[model samples]
Target: MNLDPPISSSEVTLERLDPLSAAAARPVTTGAALLALVLPPLTLLSRGHEVTQPLWLIVSYAALGGAAWLLLDRSRSTRPVWTAPSAQVFQVLLMVMLVTAAAATAGANDLVRDDWAPLVVGVLLVASTPYRPAREILFWTIVHTLLCAALGVIQAPSAITDVPALTLAVTGSFSIAVMGFAAAAYARSLTSSTQLWHDRAWQSAAAAALEHRSGVARSVQQRRVSLLNREVVPYLQRVVNADGIGDDDREEARRLARSIRTLLVSDVEKTWAQLMLDDLVGRHPRLNITAVADDPDDLGRRAVLERRTLLRALAAISVERLSATGLALRLSTPEGRLAVRWEVATPRPLPDAHRELRSMLELIRGLTLRSSVHELPGRLVIEFEYGY
Candidate 1:
């Protein structure tokens, strides 16, 4: 019999978490929320005599970018304020950065210059939408950088920039710098997202592999049991019949054949039991071996009884290769005058019994588990007197 492992509970839980779902559900961080506290005032600073120089404007925008980055990085931490209210505030601050950056680039210095506000607001709106926000962020970042490009294109159709007061070289250099920052941020987001997907994929693949191995193990056990029942026992029965016997010895020969069949069944059962134990341990390599109970009875009343019923019933059912699920067993302990009921839960609910033959067969199987299958809200429940 082949022995493998089962999937771990942690693996199952991780599959349920669904990284794509989390990423989709997560909120987007906007430029407005993060830069609101810093950039609006910077606009005022730019309006007054203090911030007229293009170099100073560049430095101001760079500082705003740095501050937004800091807030975003800090938000990633497992802090309480990273949840909602704080997140909203941070988004607003980022929006301010977007507005200020756009105005600074457009060379519109009015204190309440609403002309470029639409462009700034548009960038923020795109940045704040969830589901592939990285892509959206990248798009807006490039759009802003392209605005700088368009400005340069307008100036330098003949050369580079027409602003003789400022070097075209300087404009070109800053434009490159803006585009570089956008590219870098987009690359970072893509890298982070790819790594996240890889991690989840690896985990899911490992879980699927474990499940496959478990199936293989169960299949091997079933096949081994089948060989003993269908081939080995029948072959021995034939052998016993072939041994020529007088009429007086015929009964003895039949009894001896039955004994051999019993021995074969015992051997198969032992092999199956070993395979199950091996899988239980193999699947959970880290499970404390010393703590695991060998006897099914030691697993507690519910577990032990269920395990016993499952093993015996499975062994019997395997001979027939039954496809049934949701089996219920009702046990009657006549000596104690106690009745118990139980049913099996399966992924797919079994059909209702219509024929007497089918019902009798099901009843016989339930007698093995001391339980029976209830059709609706399908379950197998075993009910019995506690003392029994």
Candidate 2:
């Protein structure tokens, strides 16, 4: 019989959260895309300038809109391939091309003209902040800087001569790229820190549980040793000294043997629920316990483990608050659903008891498919339905 507790669902969720995956990255990607989509139209509108080729402006808007949709749609899927570096690179290149085409159609000589094309490109680059790694972000940032510089020089060859305007365009684009990279790095760091704290908490809990179980085992072993010394040891010593067994000695030996047998069989093949009830009865003789269950031997390993964990938690709560006069536990498989119902009545209200045993209750709920807790006057009832 395994006495170790099963891993709770909360632990599994925490474990999954620790690893950086597509699901974790989706929110940032989606947010960045939405921001980029909104900024371009707002930038174009704020500038209030007519383009030389209205068709090119329309095409650019359509391209940006399509890119945003692609990103938002892909983020909804959990597949890693959709968020791969290659996919991100392709999206970035598409954005750059569409922005450049728009700029070219606006007339390169009028690049320094009151147009938000450069700013739109900058925003597009920033949109990659959450999805790409630092090295990749750096590479793209440099790429955008060069693209902006080239566009400024092409729009006005004389702007190259006018270093101020040229410098402004290049520096502005570079700054936006750097800011995006910084934001992405900060976000990654925050996620890592959160996962680290979760892992530490789980480790601390596991260590505490281990120490508790070890202490319980040690205490039980000490009691067993004391029992043997008081009964079996003395009986054996007398038989050894006398060299022959008399009627009193025989009776004493038989009694000692029965005691040893009872001790050995105490918990050998009992279910966890049965063992818990026995312990509860021993501790609180006045408390009445009625239990009904399917044969534990018929249950699968996982079902048994889950049942044990649930019963152990319930037993602990009941034993600590001996206000209950009656405790009833029922376990059955009705219509192929494994169900458990526990009812307890106490002299006073246990309104705060659920809060005190919140963790245990959470573990029980996590193990089962569905469960409910009801507080009625002096009685608390909990029901759980689960599967193997």
Best by TM-score: 2
Expressed as tens digits, the lDDT of each residue in 1-388 for candidate 1 is 0011322221121112232332232244544445433544555554444233555456545545554554444322111112234434444544454444443544432222222223333333333333123443454455544444444443343431235423432443353334345544554454456557756876776676568658965766675677568755765677688766566466655675686577557545543334444444344455332111123222222233333334444423422233233333343334433343444443333443222124333333322213332444643233333221
Q: State each model's CA lDDT, in order.
A: 0.40, 0.55
Residue runs of model 1 more than 4 Å from their true location after superposition: 1-32, 36-38, 45-140, 149-388
TM-score of each: 0.29, 0.42
* Residue range 241-316, candidate 2, lDDT tens digits: 9968899998887887888778768646655455456555666666565443334653422354435555756865
Give, for candidate 2, the lowest lDDT window spanning 10 residues: 10-19
Q: By TM-score, how accurate is candidate 2?
A: 0.42
Question: Which stretches in model 2 have alpha-carbon errors above 4 Å?
Answer: 1-32, 46-50, 77-82, 86-132, 158-165, 168-172, 188-192, 195-199, 202-388
Deviation (Å) of 100 in candidate 2: 3.1
